[model samples]
Target: MKSSFLKKHFTFVFFIVFLLFSFKASAQKVRPIKSDQGEVVTMHSDILKEDRRILIYAPKDSANSEKKYPVIYVLDADNHFAQMVEYSKYLSRQDVFVIPPLIVVGITNTDRNRDLTPSHSNVDYFGKSDTTANSPYKNSGGNEHFFQFIQKELMPYVSSNYKTQPYRIFAGHSFGALTTINCLINYPDMFDAYIAVSPSFWWDQKFLLKLADKKLKAGSTLSKTLFFSDGNEDSSSPGSPFHTDVLKFDSLLKKRNIKGLDFEYMTYPAESHMTVPIKSYYDGLRFIYHQWQLPPVSDEKLNPEIVMKHYKGLSQKFGYLILPDEAYFNDLAQWLVKKPATLNNGIKLLEMNTVNYPSSSRAFTALGAAYVVKGEKQNAIASYKKASELNPTSNEIKSRLKELQK
Candidate 1:
């Protein structure tokens, strides 16, 4: 009895120790929630001089010594931080190849109006300036000071603390939109891309608009990309000003002879000021990085017989119900015919994609192409026929089979 009691006591002691360690671990400081892919992480930055919060998102692979990432600074981070974080991570995935992975710096706000507007003026949404003592304009017109914080404090802190490249993007909306455009005009070299989503052109009786007119050098080579947009809420009340100010700015940009200044303006009539960011942000990112795509395949690489098989597998992977686009099929065909040595490994890669996406007919088509190059013409014909059956309307596959028959 004595021995049994001692044994039970030892077991109880072990349980107590485990509980203590688990409790200690649970009590550790909280951090930002990790992104879905586990490659993205966010953390709060204590670099703002004002009573504001900031968040930074970096790719997990950013830790590699040789890898460098472009930085994107977003305004009103409290609202759009998560969406932008996921977009950056997924669009830059190894399989996507749309754009390079990027570091995202999201700056939250304390005094949004004071930091975003250009000049100090107490004017209501109407053209009449407000002269009242208690007007909200009392705390307005602090954008220049805020820009200094970004230049002197935030940028330096981020560059020091993270692995970053020289390329940078500045993004904002509404009042924040005005802030980005103002930065582009006043401090031209701060960022490579300036994204202004629905800027408040009515601020200070259009003080910034007038500043833009005087500021933007028409003949100079600014060498930057700028994208801005607006939603459908065209309310022109005294409090809710609505005059197509974005349109005016768009026209001005069009008339400018500024060399190397790439710009785009979008109007989402279906989306509102609140909802446009979701769509516009994705489109804007794609647009800015459009030139970063992989090189296209040449005619020598495009073997129709080999490409047809690959298309079958891809269709199965994407879902047997859907088929590969003409461009995608054409590129793969070119690669298979032009580079037979690459076919062996590339075929295996397509097989993995097919396994992951079992319904993709494109994967099967690719597999057939590899077999054909290996002197398995019959297998190639089978693959081409399967691709044609899966996607009956595919003219490329049909033509390929007819040539082989002849």
Candidate 2:
């Protein structure tokens, strides 16, 4: 009987312990994988007389913490912010380094009609005036004030809070595109590049089209990059004025041959008014930075000086000191180390990275690997030591150092 009682007690105790362990395991927290996409921030705007929201998307690479990125101020943030962020992130990847990682500041709208429209007009897009009490055009023609908001309030706020370069891009769509073109003509110096996707040139009876004709003079010097596009708005008729107006604007810019004005116009016949922005934004970025990318070349022709020269020209154009990305240099170094002739150049490029990015453990690791390839044991050990010091938790660095030490 006592054995029977003891067996029952032991079973109950084991069951309780198992239940406790299960409960404890269930209660334990799991660490979540965090995304470095971006964050939304708010600021009060005295120029607009309202609070504004700005979405900022930055590069995820923590190694380039000290790097200052070019800023893109995009209008109609509510509709296009996510798309821009994704595009910037993907296009600036190390594998597809067509464009540098950009800081995209998406400006959310409070009053779309008022802020985006350049002139107050009772007349709508169809050339019909709305005299009703609830007319949407009642609060239009605030583009100047909107520009002031961006210049005085928004720009200062972004510059103060973020690591931004002097180079800036202005991007907008439809009505927002109209504002961008207006800014381009009136305030050319505000941005280095301008992107207008399906601009509503038909607004206020084509006031902006006439303004463009007046502002852009023949043989005039307007040293800026401009990319504008139009989509198929009226599929029923190819001769519709919706697309014709854009053609007129394009012709006006082209015929004048405005000195220093770099511009490209694209037409997406398959896309509609709302869908054109996706392709146009992508093409616009590619067009503006067409010269920024380094073309692929044979390993024999690869030279660090050539890389430096390319970036120097880019720096001159951007009006800022630009350096080749750490990843780009590192990749070039790795490629160079594979060949006997380019081994020294590879080491040199890696050394340059150590100077440019002193805090990067991966840079030092890559340099160490290059030194190992060159049969320089002591140099490799030193580089690995520096890398290990920077990243103490890295088992790969630890193993590399151990293997080299042996």
Candidate 3:
């Protein structure tokens, strides 16, 4: 009886193992997703007299269209490039849609002190003069040359090579922040926007503060957006000036009464210098594009014309032709078409997309699906046919067309 019982138990265990093996064999496998984003381009700078390594990150979906996008030129590419790229990606996503798509050009530094400082000085951050032979600030004060390189060589190269809009942003941190603010003061027309995170205003005994006083005249017109912020650098006496200097700069701007200068100053007490950038950058972008998101539309008055007008106003505000994302338009149209009252409005929105994105198979597919719901059989068939022709390899589009034809 014991031997019989043991054989039955072994049989049951083997059956369970067989079933597990069968399930494992039948299941589909998935590989890990590898993300290799951005492109590295080497460009020679005549003014700087060195080959500059430029890290360029365009919207991943931008390859399909000839649309131009705003550009952000970030100083300290090695430290901040990828972070900017990711931020741009998330903000410009179809769902989030806070900012328009951007082309981020990250300019790396060959000489940190030389390129980022505004004036040649042996004075360190702590208001102490170091005239030693091996001082860290020996090669300082090349901000003018750096700006020349950016304005003359770098900007032109990016503009010519990439589909870029007229609006541009200059972003930096620490001495890089000082450089950006200096550029804004001296070269106001250089960029449409400026972002200075924890600018090293203590450089050269607060030379930038003095310069700002001189350059930013009474009621001068800046006509630009500037977002600058600082962390709790005053946690110790050694770094207190960083906090105070930014405060002074903010006060100067308020006193100057600069016209058309949309700016914001933020303070992050919990963050240290090293960690402040992440929060500062995120908030800076939000501040720069504070009024970017579309206002809520009532379901009763939901119409494509309102959407169109909103984007036109955005284009005017941003100084560029801003269009709604194609995917978002499709999703919005589908949502709008749920009620009979807004069906034609939804159709009109999709039509606007077809006009904006003439070559997108997905756009046509979406339009066709909308037409099908509207019971416009002929229109749906024609839209499906166009989509299939655009994407000949798409069996799904072909199937839709075939069903519509039948």
Candidate 4:
């Protein structure tokens, strides 16, 4: 009987150990990706007085032998890092591109409340004070320390490790969002863009709100892009101030008569605190980089050498299926024509368009025009003939051919 009992007990112990090990392994493992431009790296920071974990996501090209990208520093990295990285990649895809491809630096938190809050205050939501034996506010404010970690430790590490631009963005939600807002109100020059999704306006009974009222005086030049938002979780009843806090903040800024402040506010009627980041992050990114749709000017010209260097990779990335739309290609052609002694580059751009849009008569015509400018009459005549054949009804094509022949 004793021998039988020992065998059964040993089996049970083995199963328990197996279960525990499985759980531990699952907790430590990061999510798997088929293709990724970023990885989760741990940083042992003596500055924050603790070992910190950071998730760094970059453009796919950023990892290639030679490339660089701008970086966005995100708060609450543990919860939202992968999602933001995926969003950045998909949105900045060649077709859906609304913003420049960017790197994401997600900063994981040790003490979320402590590091996110600006001031150590005991004030509660009811407009009363907390004087308990174990008040949560005991470690309420550590924004300065958190900023130190980012500025002293994180920034240097990223700059030294990655090729980054002077432009950077700070993004967060809830308490994390409050931290971003605090940075903007107090240290406006800290970042290029500030994305605060539903910051806790209830914090210390509108501490940051009051600060904005005071600091953003009439016609103050706060040259920055700020995008903030709230969600429907605050919608308990009609005409309630619960969800109107962001609106109130928006109005306050308008009333402040602040100049050089490019800002936009959005309210999600269906999103709650936890879910707002999914949509808000994508939208905020687009809002900040809306200049992408503007026409490419002479100064905005793509360097031929740089274009040639990255062209093959870029073509492969877009699956070598580029289409020359009238709007986009025309702009590129105008940019190319402005540079003297770059007819070869101009011809190259036109050829790219022809390959993408083989059916486009305008593409051939543009190619012909560039050849004519280079005194290549034979090539120009061939292109003009093709253009006339493709678009036989166009009187403009006939006029061009007649003029070129003379």
Candidate 5:
């Protein structure tokens, strides 16, 4: 009886081992999902003497092979990186058509109080200083060094590694907003645009407001875009100094009439300080790209030349060679191809896209479709062949080419 029991136990153990091995093999066969949103990059900052983690989000468009995107550098990335990424992705969609695709560079903070504040004051928000060892503002007043870290270390790294345009935007909130204003006043040429949400203007007894009044001279040619906002911090009280300070800043800008300085001010009475970033960011983006929307092109006046001229104007404004988005142009071409009056224009636009995005299989395939619609059999076949060569794995292109050839 004992020998028989031991034999059964050994058999059970052998079965368990086999099951474990099978499970291991099955786990190895599974593949991980690949993310194209962006990646986390770590770099050592010589200016700050610390390793910084930057979050980058680039648009996933193969047709933008030769195109460069504008970069937005945001502070306090840990709290707002994902929001900014989502905003850029959604607004820049071909259908939404609100803004252009942007490269969001989120600079994660190592020390928020130290890196974000402009002045090294131990005084708290209530105008009282805590001299205790546990005080959070001990390492404050590092903004100068932080800006150096960005200008000298971080910007160079991003410019070298990413497909970036000459135009750049600086964005921040609360204390970060104060830092942004400081940069604007001291280093005005650092960024082409600025977004400051709920700036803590009360910091160090409204130091920044005084500085802005002194620095931004009347009729000065600033040639920059600024979007700033304040939240419902005063509880609807007319005497709320927080809101008053922002108003003062706004009044100063208006009085100065600084030439070339395109500025907008907004007050969010419904949103608190923490909840204000979302709406402010959306409005800020719209204001900055107010001139980006293409004019209405009806079926009667579907002109590729009009589109080209608009983009050329945009290119000059942005100080870079900007072209119409490939997907936008392709969708326009497809729509135009259906109308006999606009069919020729559609074909011309597709041809232009193929030239602008030479390596894009989608562009070539789109051109081929337009040719097919025009009954240009030879041109259609040639375009499809080139597309198939560019994207060897595209069975759809191969199938279409075979049908055309036959």
Candidate 6:
């Protein structure tokens, strides 16, 4: 009777699988790719007295997870927001894990000149003073108020609505770059790092340069990261104030040698003002997290302690409590257990994930699989039971537990 029932059940299961495959093979649909776009948000700002539009790109992994991400504020969102979002996504990929997942906030401009300049001036780039009634620089020198808008409205909104780390980065180009440097000098505590691409240092006859010397006192402690670069801008020949001004700023930074001021300066002679941001932003991000990559470890030496210690070092450097992602540890452990030499070490790695994320059903499920590899059926049963309790709807966990019990 048992043999007859088994034969019939196998036939029925095979017939059902065949029918499903045949249906899928006969019917097909052209599918569009899922959009990988971020959210567009608008908030009314009392400081600016306008409805500010912004773009936000957060890591997908942040959803339904307790992970918090650092933020980078991008100026000229119309042009550079997508680029920074792509950089943040690609650099933090599992395969190319050089930096942590970042949340990018692209701040759109209401008045470009008024918000991005430090001083009121009718002068334009190339040292030409446009004193006409319609000068673009007429609405300039509201940078201090711009900073207030960010601090009072934008930053608070992001913090209240999203999971964010304490570290923040400010980035810009041209006039926006000038604004970034001005923020560094005046509102130093607003952001931890700053990126400036081809800043109009010649604005107001080198006003920011003079201010940098005065505000950034010699040997003072301004423990911040700054990456500034300039493009050709016809700077190859003599009397190119655009390139010369940046060189002078670099000289001043080197001369002052402000304590704890980590900075880098690069000049891209081949690139024009319009094209330098491509390479400049990429290199700037790499420079910011220069030591973020984990050192290579042989399987024999790889252990949970080493992984934990690596993240701890990063936490100290970034002034936040950084922990290894649960998925990363689970993958590493599974790979380790594939080889007999590292089987026990792999189990240890899985155990560490449980300690770090006790409430995670996935972590517990992974640990159970590692125990199964070691032929510890009782331990595996216990792990699956805990996982099932944490996630009662998981049929896979229930089936695994039943199989082990039987």
Over 242-261, each residue of candidate 3 has an lDDT whose tens digit, in order, gives 78889999999999999999
Ranking by lDDT: 2, 6, 5, 3, 4, 1
lDDT string for model 5 (124-239, tens) is 86678877788888888889999999999889989998888899999999998899889988988899999999898888778889889889999888988999998997875556
Sequence-dependent TM-score of model 4: 0.66
Report the Cα RMSD per candidate: 14.7, 6.9, 4.6, 14.6, 6.5, 11.1
Q: For residue 330, what is the lDDT in candidate 6? A: 81
Global lDDT of each model?
0.72, 0.91, 0.88, 0.77, 0.89, 0.89
| Local accuracy of candidate 4 as per-residue lDDT tens digits, 51-156 | 8889898665421223456679999988888878888887776556666568899988888878999988887655678779677777888998888888888989
Candidate 6 lDDT, 374-395, residue by residue in tens: 9999999999998999999989
- Write one digit per residue (lDDT tens) for candidate 2, span 14-109: 999999999999999999987665889998887787889889887656666777889999999999988888889889888888898899999999
Q: For model 3, what is the alpha-carbon lDDT of residue 307?
A: 80
Which stretches in model 5 have alpha-carbon errors above 4 Å? 1-37, 63-66, 236-239, 385-399
TM-score for each of the candidates: 0.64, 0.86, 0.88, 0.66, 0.86, 0.89
Alpha-carbon shift of residue 380 in model 2 (angstroms) = 2.1
Clashing pairs in 2: none
Worst 10 residues of 5 by lDDT: 58-67
Candidate 3 regions exceeding 4 Å error are 1-33, 338-342, 388-395
Better of 2 and 6 by TM-score: 6
Off by over 4 Å in 4: 1-33, 62-64, 124-130, 236-241, 294-406
Give the CA lDDT, 0 to 100, for residue 121 in model 2.
92
Off by over 4 Å in 1: 1-51, 62-66, 127-134, 235-243, 298-341, 344-406
Comparison by TM-score, 1 against 4, better one? 4
